[model samples]
Target chain A: MEMFVHDETPTAAVDQREQVVSALAGSVRDLVDATIRSTVADEELLAVRAGVDALVARLRTEQRPGPAGVRYNSEGRSWSWGNAVVGHGNAIAPPLAIDHDTERGRSRAEVVLGAAYEGPPGMVHGGVSALLLDQIMGETASGFKRLTMTGTLTLRYRRPLPLGPVALECWIASEAGRKVTVEASIGNADGVAVEATGLFLVPRWAPLAADEQPEGWRRSAEG
Target chain B: MEMFVHDETPTAAVDQREQVVSALAGSVRDLVDATIRSTVADEELLAVRAGVDALVARLRTEQRPGPAGVRYNSEGRSWSWGNAVVGHGNAIAPPLAIDHDTERGRSRAEVVLGAAYEGPPGMVHGGVSALLLDQIMGETASGFKRLTMTGTLTLRYRRPLPLGPVALECWIASEAGRKVTVEASIGNADGVAVEATGLFLVPRWAPLAADEQPEGWRRSAEG
Candidate 1:
């Protein structure tokens, strides 16, 4: 079995399903934020939990055996609805909209993190910043054409990132054989908060030149 | 205005609230997992979304203005219900129950990664591993006493961790003045998967002898 799934589902059908999934995730994200900050009475809270459980059972009546792995159709549309960083259907994922400039070998995203992403009193969690950087760097290194795994990630917390709108940008800094070096950062209006440098390795099993497409891999607009 | 909130709520009251919050979060986590792997028809999925939204509205009836910052009561009971890594009320936080061995200067935890925590196929997300390490190392350095912030965190992905039970352990490797160096790792039944080293720093403004407690800070069982 190939790692990259060649999903034969039609592009139109995939898009429709993505819309439904994204909508559900958005509401769940709101539910999470509300749960953290709620001051409702215990009885009401219990009532809400029961409601949530009922909903879960309804969704589970028909389900996949495992996770929603990255899949691409013949029309070059791909989606990894379960991705931790950018899954459209992942409620816990920060609301990040990344712009991939493959030609420029760079990627950028802007997101407004709310209460759910906090670590320190009013600052973004350090690991959340790392999560964003890793995703963007991985995408930048892979360029949505090849498979690259994060080899090593180093982060320096130069400043505390306040919980609010933040910007992230990453670019391919260098490449040596199968290893790609990527530099990234998460910042706000003041300046950069966290700086990251990552080494991404193209596994030997999926080695392919930049211009050549691997047998089972298909390029997609989303991943 | 203190960074660590001195919540006047009694310890018993806090515990009662925590139980309620935890139950709600537990259900939400299940909802997240079910949504990820659900292959339900579009109509059923849409119906589930409606149900989820109703629950969100009910929970939001009375909500705090912002995130749940770290809080401690007079009884030395602390709770950070919104902490991204270990918040009892946070559905997105991995189910990490850390055992703080202050005497031996070590901390450990074990959790099972479900479908919600995946990244590269069947493997755990690299960022999730970093997240767990950062939280455990932070607690290890602080020892639930003085406050310490992450200054630098470096991680090496030695192997990919599958979606299942994993162990995490961290210890205070060294300490110099206000800086503490901690080493930690996440491993499966097979062996270590990710290795981490972190520098946790005590801000000069809140410095205190390890044996002395800060004026506004109270040691808590959880943070």
Candidate 2:
């Protein structure tokens, strides 16, 4: 994966960072799928885990202490590499790259599930589907510029989702003070497998002003 | 841990089967916890994996030909061993045993989470907390005499919850034709850790009449 360290580039450096982050995310997604489908032997698995642990330790030696909160540049670009939904470095994320259509208040992403996400035989784990829906719905509720937390989310699994390429879509249904409602779905080429509705809340404790919100809120909602 | 099967008395016979199912579920939960916390040598882990695979094969020797759908009895007892939220035989569940107070429209449960439920260091996984809340809220919405599915749920993690015993409480706030609203919370001996609100829906496809409602819905919602 490509790596970069903060330097003296102008805040306009956002575009370059976005590109690098996207490429890394794609690689991480591929890595996850490989890890799942690999027919590697036990000894090989142990060796890989050990290598990964060493790499983690090496990164820890140079990292800031604490979770990677969201960060943004003056040019209005933000990134969150530790995000459970869309983090570039999180192998567990299914690494979805969601695209938002601002005018339509909608978003969509495509992803593939492999062994790591399987539950029933070849079917994707139900919880994994819920996690993806949660993120997309949260993004839809926030509309890329506000703060929202999953207040409530409901999902229905009409059929088992096989482990393979799938698509996800989400859009805002309604909004109220401190509350936004979102609708989302996940499906394969055949048809929709799961449907979801969410009630996302900007917690009473959270700031409501657009400019005063934390960067984490912005990145999660927008990206 | 308790066996209670008898073929003579109808209720006793049913209870006996439930006991066996419960024991299997307990074993599964134990297996999950063991897998998470095991620090066994690589060779031992491989051996364990082989043993587990063998056991799975043996169990499949006489298994049903289809998914374990929800089941109920004429006497109004119900069991869903494969339910994601409260399945008696699911290793992934904390296996919550919820108690309802129909008169008060409230429900409560106690459970202990171990290594398998960890997210942050020494803390219960956030998703686990959400899972527990969903089940309880769904029950509250149903009032133990109807059927309801989660439509939306909102949670706030006021603080990190340590992995150990926790108490959960839920109560209905209001209801409409297809919607039931619920309020819930989770805490330990010290105090509350998280609070939740949820909206549950009885799918438009589901029946509304008390007499026509499925027995499983009646027991889960009313019990």
Q: What local distance difference test score does each model get? A: 0.82, 0.59
TM-score of chain A of 1: 0.93
Which residue ranges in model 2 land beyond 4 Å of their true spot? A1-223, B1-10, B204-209, B212-216, B219-223
User: Which digits, one per residue and each the tens of the lDDT, describe model 1 over residues A8-48?
Assistant: 99999999999999888888888889889999999999999
- TM-score of the second chain, each candidate in turn, equals 0.94, 0.86
For candidate 1, the per-residue lDDT at B149 reads: 78
Best candidate, DockQ: 1
Candidate 1 recovers a fraction of native contacts equal to 0.67
Candidate 1 docking class: medium
lDDT of 2 at A77: 56
Q: Write the per-residue lDDT of candidate 1 for residues B1-223, one digit (tens) a residue.
A: 1166878999999999999999999999888888888888888888888888888888888988888888877777788888888889999897588998998889999999887777776667788888888788888888867778788989998877888899998999998988999999999899999999999888887755655765345332222
TM-score of candidate 2's A chain against the true A chain: 0.80
lDDT (10s digit) by residue, model 2, range A1-223: 1112223436656455444444433443333333333333334434444443333333333333333335555545566554545655343455678999967989999997654454333455555676677667767777766666555556666766876899999988987788888899999999998888877778787777678766435654521
Give iRMSD, candidate 1.
Answer: 2.8
